[model samples]
Target: MSTVTGSTTAAISSAVATTTAAAQASVQAAAQSIISGSTNSSMDTSSLVTALVNSKTAGQAATIAAEQTADNTLISAYGTLSAGLSALQAAILPLSDGATLNTFKTTLSGTGVTATAATGAVAGSYSLNVAQVATSQVLTSAGYNASTNLASGSATMTLTVNGQSSTISLNSSNSSIAGIASAINSANDNPGVTATVVTGSDGAHLVLQSNSTGASSGISIAISDSTSTDDLNKLAVTTTAGKSISSASDLTGTDSSGNTINPSQSTISGTGWTQTQAAQDSYFTLGGVGVSSSTNAVNTALSGVTLNLTSAAVGTTQTLTVAQDTSAESSAIDNFVTVYNTLVTTMGSLTTYNASSTSQGVLLGDSTLSVIQNQLAKIVGSGVGSGTTKTTLAAIGITLQADGTLSVDDTTLNAALQNNQSAVTSLFNPTTGIAAQLDDSITNYTSSGGIIQNRTDAINSDLTSLSNQQTTLTAWQAQLTSQYTAQFTALDTLMATMNNNSQYLTQLFGGTNSAGALATNKG
Candidate 1:
């Protein structure tokens, strides 16, 4: 027992001395009770066994608990450190890649025209005059009854738009005007065409409109009906190339019968189609040079800039000015500084040690945290390059403070972003920027299989070991309790028998001055 106790004590030398002393005192008290009670009555065997078992296992149990607590604290501390590093990484990613620094903004002087500038757009001012906005071709057929059958037996209607054609089978089931419109809309292979029925004062007019805007996106329909003179033949029309019509007068004024023509109604002439609206391209001028676009959104006219023109922009001249966005850049840099300072503060609290109060942080002497702090400080305090052209955070009004946090001067930062954009770009270059370096370091520290994860894994392993040790100690304690209980109970029975025997002997053979039965018989 002494050898086992010595070995256990040496293994858990860091266990609290008071706990071990208390266990020892309990065992001593139980032993004293047995010794003093030998002359009086049988000892409390159950309490003696419990005290002995507790004395043997108390140090090991306390050691396991303390070590497990320390390991858990370390694990939690690593989690906190990892979280701080991740937040800092998120704040610096955009700056590191130069996405935040290279942003551009566009200013337009007139209404109905909006412009957006992206990367590669140069700073400049240009005059833009929009002559016409693009429109889609809309063709309406002659008026017909809503329920009138347009086709007889099996027939096929092929609709073409923008050089792409789709043939939909039109039979007696879907030969009506409304049925034809529904078939056209539900056709899976439709080539950008929408059909609708407009109920005017005359009757229902089948309207076919191109789904796209441009000169080539005109709608044309061809029908092969069972009969030559079927009503479906009236729906057959050929595409007409769009022309620039400035006013209603530019359209055909009269039909062959000298009747005043209604341009809104379909008057199938030689082309077999009526053009309610032309499929003309958008016409605009940039810097006094004429340009045409198939859509209102003209992206090809300017490098890295898209111009959105509305109908109201026609015949109006607007000024488009492109410049770098300074405010966004400033905000991004400021956010980076703020997040970095927060990380620094968190790290300080984790690793601080108070000498006067004798209170230490959970990770006060952790080497991993120390190394991480040193690496970050080295990068932040150093400059990107050497010589006069070199730039640093200090040059951009971001300074490292005595307490390892950062301070930003907004006025200086804005000035640097506005005037010295090149230097700023160089400092935040995608490859060698300070933010990029910091991001890389943080990734290494916080990523899977990184330092923090490895440390946490090690601590968890220590906890598992402590649990196993605790399990073994509990088993030993149970075994020791059983053995002690048996031995003490047997000793208690023997002592009780001996005490009873002494009383019997005193009664039979009288002591000192008392006569016994044996003495009386001898006299």
Candidate 2:
């Protein structure tokens, strides 16, 4: 009996423990009641079955739970590390590409003049004097009756400005002065000309203005009258034959009727149109040299520099100084330092160990995190070249700290940008710069299918595996419950039957506390 019991105990120990103490206790109570011959045949066989099943599967269940928890924590830790790396990447992008360091600022000593310098602009000062601003041409026609028809039949009016011309056909429908103005204003192929009608006491006058400002943007109109009676010839203006209305001498010409046209007696000059404003180019001097532009916004005068001119700046000399934008460079470097320090802090927290408290970070001693930290530190501390050409962040006021962070010296940084811009450029060059090196490394560590993601994927796969194990354990538990329920139920009935037989014998042949039925009858 002892051997069989020991073997059974060994088998039970081989399985796991997942059963509640209450279920085991209920089974024990039922067995005790049967042994004591209480005549109670009912037993909590379900509790006994549950207790046995849990015991067989508890170990595997605990193992799966532990592994799942560990995998999930590792995944979360990698997520935090990835976020830190991405932030560091963003902070270094502009610096890595050399955009931040190549910036320049423009300064002008006078008002009404603004300038901007692009990447390739040279750092220097130049004296700029605005002689005149560009002006657009304006031509006003002689007044005529607004409702009177100008074209006797179908005639064409050609409007030309800046060498481009548009011709409109006029008949009885649009022959009036206002109709002609509207037709010119609404023509789809109209050149650089805007037409408007100004109604004065003298009747309606057609005004034509150039859309652009320049010497070449003068306006000219030629009228093709269909017949001799057509009044469309009254709007003809010609700049050919040196007969521009803007000339100092009053232009002289003959009217359509072969009559001598005098400027003093007519509102229109002999050129057939009155000049309100002459088209002219903008004139400015740079370093005592003359420059001209068709527009006030001048970009071609200086390389990588554009000057915005205004009439208020005319007749005055101003100084334009182009220099490296040290402020922006400094700010960018400072931001890099700040974000790098934050990354360092995050990494430190992730890998921290506390001997006194007997505790450590979740990702403590992770090989991937260690490699990333070491590589970043190596790049940040390394110099660019060898020997005399060697340049490091220290040369530009950025230095590595004892706690694995960076610090900046503003005065040194500004002076380096102002005086030794080339050295700064070399230090932050796009291909071999410190920021570029770090950016490349971070991309490898945090980008899609990179180291961090690979690790996270592995952990997720492990979690799935753990989940499968849990499912298998659950199935095994169910099987154990079914088997145990039948065995325990049969054993319970056998025990109850044996207890009842013992009770019947105790009553028939009295033993210990009770006399037998035959002995009581003899007494």
Candidate 3:
């Protein structure tokens, strides 16, 4: 709307504004870029450091993955070994050469058995020499006078053991048959002494017997306190201060003999504590026939254990048989198969790769996985050392599933155990069976180019290459952005200087020209 000169003035002002706006925009863009770099794009190093640590083994995912790798090896070994063992029982034969006639057996009749003299027979041939489970001895010190209730003569008696001694004493009130036993037992109640009251043809007399059994249970009592009738004939107290048997449980003290004695639990019923006789060989029973002890025959050709039981004295050899547990063996085989299948599947997942996927997921369908599967499949079919019977797991009850998993055939396994157990034992036991064979195989494979080892090596190599590429990409992006900023900033600065010079020239000409001089004169 203004005249020509005014329009020119407005145009110059517009140019200055445009130039200043351009410079401001360029400066702002540079500032924003620098801020953005400091806030988000610059390499802070902390994140990369964390990533490296995570990649190495600090993070949960990496640590667990690494640990699982080691665990798989050990678990696979155990599975292979267990699957190969043949089911068997303990090797020790029951009731063998150590057999001895322990019990006297007879019908309801009071008739006794005729004891035969064998190489092991101790004293009598037809009759057995059985040790006393319990005994009562009515002992009266030779020096002791029953009528006077005191030591009548110079007979002496003493009980000593373990350097401690207590002379036997009896009060007149305690002179009664039961009373004397009660008093002696009370005094010797500490450990080694076991005295009880028993009534027999001799009336009630204090029965003194060693509580210990065999050579260890003893009763040592000397005649130091002896009188003619009351003198102890078994033991002699030395001139030294006699240490008496202080307790019922002490092994060193006894009544008269040099036997160790320790009294056991005392009950009120007839079932009082008694010395346990040495356990002798005894026979178990079967069919009404009394199978003689000799029938318990054990044959080593079977390589299995045997337990022989007897019923009676006049019996012929009646063999008893123990069986191997087929159900358990089947279950164990099933577990091994299950775990093995899992391992196979896991291995497949590890090696298989999908070409369609741009992202790496699983390493399935790999050569390493195939090798692992082949090695494992061979284990079930493998044989043990010269095995006549037990060989294949499938022969017992193990079967593979459609998805390459395994299932146990319990029915077949049970039948095998019932029909032929020796074969089963040969198959599983490691000492001579396939179970041991598996251990050797696992050891061979996991050594170096083993499936797991080779796969791990490959994955690690790939990770290293991927990491290097990621670093290069980030650095290239940063360099490109820096180049773009430099080019744009230089162009903005050049535009700002040109616009400023153009404004300065327009103002100078308008202020000093002839038109300006004429205007001033008219004013």
Each prediction's TM-score against the native? 0.88, 0.76, 0.39
Segments of candidate 3 deviating more than 4 angstroms = 1-214, 217-321, 348-361, 381-391, 429-434, 444-451, 461-492, 502-523
TM value for model 1 = 0.88
For candidate 1, give the lDDT of residue 88: 90
Clashing residue pairs in candidate 1 (N, C-alpha, C atoms within 3 angstroms)? none
Residue 237 of model 3 has an lDDT of 18
* Alpha carbon RMSD to native, model 1: 5.4
Model 2 stretches astray by more than 4 angstroms: 1-51, 141-158, 163-187, 195-207, 222-273, 356-359, 477-523
Give the per-residue lDDT digits (tens) of candidate 2, residues 213-288: 7667777788888686677887887542222233212324566898875221113243447878767667778877
Q: Which 10 consecutive residues of model 2 have the lowest summed lDDT? A: 1-10
* Alpha-carbon deviation at 37 in model 3, angstroms: 19
- Candidate 2 lDDT score relative to the true structure: 0.77
User: Considering every candidate listed, which one attains the maximal lDDT?
Assistant: 1
Off by over 4 Å in 1: 1-15, 32-42, 243-273, 509-523
Root-mean-square deviation of every model: 5.4, 8.8, 19.2
Say which prediction, candidate 1 or candidate 3, comes out ahead on TM-score: 1
